[model samples]
Target: MTTLFYRKIYAMKTADSTEFYVVRHGQTAANLQARIQGQQDTLLDETGELQVNCLAEFLKDAKFDIVYVSDLKRTRATAAAIMQYHPDTPVFFTPELREWHLGALEGRSFAELNAAYPLLMQQIRQSSFDAAPPEGESMLQFQERINRFMEKIASEHPNQKILLVTHGGVLQRIFNLAVGVVGSGNLRPLCHNASLSVFQRRNAQWQLAVWNNTSFMHLTSANDTITL
Candidate 1:
């Protein structure tokens, strides 16, 4: 339950400006079971639902202009909880925002994957930018996918506060891109479930405003007995 928040000040505001409030979806069955999930769509468990509701309550005052979510079930559910209050606000579903395609690794427990392909798993953990897991997407491929999705968002909404519900891998890539950090060597830790990471656009550049603000975690814990 550590909350991290950062902000940058900028004077310029463009007519096509966009503020991205990125959120990782609530915990899924895969998360609780320590599975690779990847692009697989899983429904939110009871705790996951509560987590999203808490996040919705925390973000209710922010008044986002638009809500965007991955087409994946977990992310869609998370976005639904937030958009419930602002029924008038439009919600956009994008498949490009989906999690890294885990390929054959999808829906398998991490332990099982490692046990079956220990060396390959080791290579991935050691930095497998070019190497793809057995029928899985490479780290480089994931980065490219995230970049395309981000560029689309930039083009679609330039000057508006947007709420995005996506996955941990996608957000990590975005953090790296915004900070001018690239490559699989220096990946940021995965975002927490239902956590918010804010980014601001200024002078045609994206700046990281915050990284993994878990205020929602506190709010969720206040009313729920579950621990993640």
Candidate 2:
């Protein structure tokens, strides 16, 4: 694993300032099956619903100025769960926050895809952000899309606390670009279900405040386990 370190050039901002809390949705059937979902729409399972409910309870007392979510069902469901607590906050949906398009690998189990296209799989594992799957969007395309989404969020909610429900790949790219950790040839490890990550902007520059924070789990039932 790569060791990451950042210098704290500024103090953490108050809650009223522009703060981004990113969340990856709970697990879906595809995730449980270990299949590549890409752009394919998948619904969250019972465990996912419970996880989101736990997240909702955790945020019930917190305040948010705006909420954003991917148009995909999984993200939408997670957003809806969060909205149960912050019903008055506006929720915006955008496709730009969707997962990386795995193209021909979509809906295929990882084992099957590796068995069928071993060379392609190997290339993808070793490729940089410009790598493309057969008939799929390149990493560059995904970066552009994520950048646009981040720009829109920053422009629209410059000084408000904003929550975004999105995919793992989307969050990974955002973290990479925000902290100048680009082109590392690998995405950050997958985000756990209902995990919360925080980002802050200061003086016109963005910095990662937290990454893959699972503390929200404390709000859930002691027996609760997020399986995604």
Candidate 3:
């Protein structure tokens, strides 16, 4: 969609509200193979490059005051593509915006992991609020991290437009937080690669303006929520 469309739909921003144009990073080989990426720093695959190119074109005319990107290869690449339009826009690379650190399970395919760690896989699939991969952050810890980062940014930049390039898990956490979902056992729509989601913070409250918008990509691909 065009930037004009975005402005029309989100025209409620006041002098104190903050707008967030959040984007999940493009695809990777792990995404196609159903592997857990976590903090692996995987590069984008061929299709991922094309997806981000389309996304960059779609957002080329959007105005952004600042940009926040996850300190990972996939997210960085995606952010780079989009920031080409706003060369002078200040960008911050932070690990706090990175994917849930799956630790030892970072490189394993879903089927392989399920075969070896059935109970853990079950917990992950069920979205057990406390379940975590070996040596990884639990669902609670991840949620806290995301909440802290979001609060910090919103407090720092009022009445400004911000662009956030992160991961699917982070997007999912943001959605959960916006909807008052404390724990797991709740179903969420899949966050496709290179999808765009928008949130607005007004009077210290965050509201979802859009969710899982992939119209720019022309096609949708695997998301981190995929499972066998």
Candidate 4:
């Protein structure tokens, strides 16, 4: 029930811009338990199913030219719900959009990770963007992956509407990129499960249009450490 406001960036609409509608996958049992999903391919729980069904109906009339989804089950399932309304749109499932690889931290709660991996927990506490968990990606690596995917899409789909179904980590990173947020302690936009965030890339610049929109679901969402 707290309200957070990020610095908004405004730009003139151009013919070369691409409109992006980004959706985070719905709630999962892991999310409810505060467990780290991190590419674990968890399925949607009942609440998640209902959330997506509502979201699907809300976006049924959007004129998206193409759809891109993370290959993870949660995102795929969410996208499937929405895609039923856009049956002919081209949908591409790619691992490039997967959540941050959490490695040994996967499936463990934050409390459990603090107990099991003190050093890793300390690194995270210190906001070590370059530090990675055992067998996982660093924050920097995750950001780079998102950057590459975004650049590819912006380059390839100018003047087109895109529907991107992916993880909250990706959406969080995109929010940071758009608003020039750096370091730690700054408030990040809340990424509710099954929420929709909109962005536009015009002349190679990213502008955030909407964020953390869950009005269609008509319900508060669960949060997890992995998703922020």
- Please name the candidate that would achieve the greatest TM-score relative to the true structure: 3
- Rank list by lDDT: 3, 4, 1, 2
Worst 10 residues of 2 by lDDT: 1-10
lDDT of 2: 0.77
- Root-mean-square deviation per candidate: 2.8, 3.7, 4.5, 4.5
Give me the runs in candidate 2 sitting further than 4 Å from their true place.
1-17, 222-225
Judged by TM-score relative to the true structure, which candidate is superior, 1 or 3?
3
Candidate 4 ranges beyond 4 A from true positions: 1-14, 122-127, 182-187, 219-228
Of 1 and 2, the candidate ahead on lDDT is 1
lDDT of each: 0.79, 0.77, 0.82, 0.81
TM-score of 2: 0.87
What TM-score do all the candidates reach, one by one?
0.89, 0.87, 0.89, 0.86
Cα RMSD for predicted model 3: 4.5
The residue-level lDDT of candidate 3 at 31 comes to: 93
lDDT (tens digit, per residue) of candidate 1 on 1-228: 645554331332346567888999988888999898888879988888888888888777676778888999999999989888888888889888998887888888889989997876776675457658667678788788887878777777777788889999889888877887765565556577888888877667878877887655666554555565
Q: Indicate the residue-level lDDT of 4 in model 1.
A: 56
Error of 3 at 67 (Å): 0.3
Best by lDDT: 3
Q: By lDDT, is 1 or 3 better?
A: 3
